[model samples]
Target: MLLKIDVASTVPLYQQIHDQIILGLASGQLQPDEALPAVRQLADELAVNMLTVAKGYNLLKAEGYLISDRRQGTRVAANFQADAVFMQALQEQLHQLTAAAKIRGLDVKDVQELVAAQYQSFEGE
Candidate 1:
């Protein structure tokens, strides 16, 4: 899998990395049991601090998206319960979207249609 980082954005580098990793897993770009780049290796490759990559991996581990050990280094969590992960992420996005839509006078039907249309673009990808 390829990981990209943009430094100028308001989001922290580590957060951006972590979010993309989660997105990758959700989209099945990275399979369960896939090995992740070591913190030092990724940091060197990305030209970012090692601590940043470590922080991202730590957060993923804490969230059960990654399992790390000294010998294995780090790998995607073996628990491939896609339904739970995808739905949880979807629900979190919905919560944020709902708050924004409320301020803009949009409702559930509008959000539902928007999501359905967007998801259609991902069919069989």
Candidate 2:
């Protein structure tokens, strides 16, 4: 998987990394049991500090999207589940996105069509 960092963005480097990783997982670009790059390696590639990469990795681990061990390194969780907390957070994000769409004069059907297209795009991939 390829990861990119936007140095000038308002989002923190670690967060941008974390978000991309999450999207990869959700979109099936990163598969279960897949090995992730070593923190040092990823940091070097992204031109960021090791600690920054570690922070993102730790967050993913805590969120149950990744598993890390000395012998196996870090891999995507083999059996991941989106628990109540995760669902709630996801719902809030969707609400915010839909609200923005509405403010931009997108009707409910327009938003639904966009959502459907995005969901189908993932399936085609």
Candidate 3:
């Protein structure tokens, strides 16, 4: 997967990496059981610190989006389920985003359309 990191953005490098990987999975650019580069290798390719890559990988592993073993190195988890904890967090985030959209003068239909467009983009990918 190709990760594009914006050095000028306020977001941290590791977060960019983490978010991009998730996007890749959502877009089908990454598949279940797909192997990922080693920490050192990805760090070198991204011209970032190895620790940064490891931190992102570790977070994904902890979140059950990835798995690591000596035999397979690091690979996408073969199965991932959105448990209640994740669902709650997602609902909270959506609530915040919807509130922000309302404050910005976006009607419900506008927000729904925007959401549909984004969802369709993922589907097309």
lDDT of each: 0.88, 0.92, 0.94
User: What digit string (tens of lDDT, one per residue) describes model 2 on residues 1-125?
Assistant: 89988999999988998999988987889999999999999999999999999999999998898999999999999997778989998899999999999899999999999999988977876
Candidate whose lDDT is highest: 3
lDDT of 1: 0.88
Candidates, ranked, lDDT:
3, 2, 1
What are the C-alpha RMSDs, in order, of all predicted structures? 2.8, 1.5, 1.1
Best by TM-score: 3
Model 3 Cα shift for residue 34 (angstroms): 0.5
Q: What tens-digit string does per-residue lDDT give for candidate 3 at 1-125? A: 89889889999999999999999999999999999999999999999999999999999998889999998899999998999878987899999999999999999999999999999999988
TM-score of each: 0.83, 0.89, 0.94
Q: Mind sharing the TM-score for model 2?
A: 0.89
lDDT of 1 by residue, 8-122 (tens): 8899999988999988886779889999999999999999999999999998887889998889989999895647877898789889988999899988899888888767655
Backbone clashes, candidate 3: 0
Better of 1 and 2 by lDDT: 2
Per-residue error for 101 in candidate 3, Å, reads 0.5
Q: What value does the lDDT take at residue 103 in candidate 1? A: 93
- State how far residue 3 of model 3 sits from its true place (Å): 1.3
Candidate 2 residue runs with Cα over 4 Å from true position: none
Query: What's the residue-level lDDT of 20 in candidate 2?
Result: 96
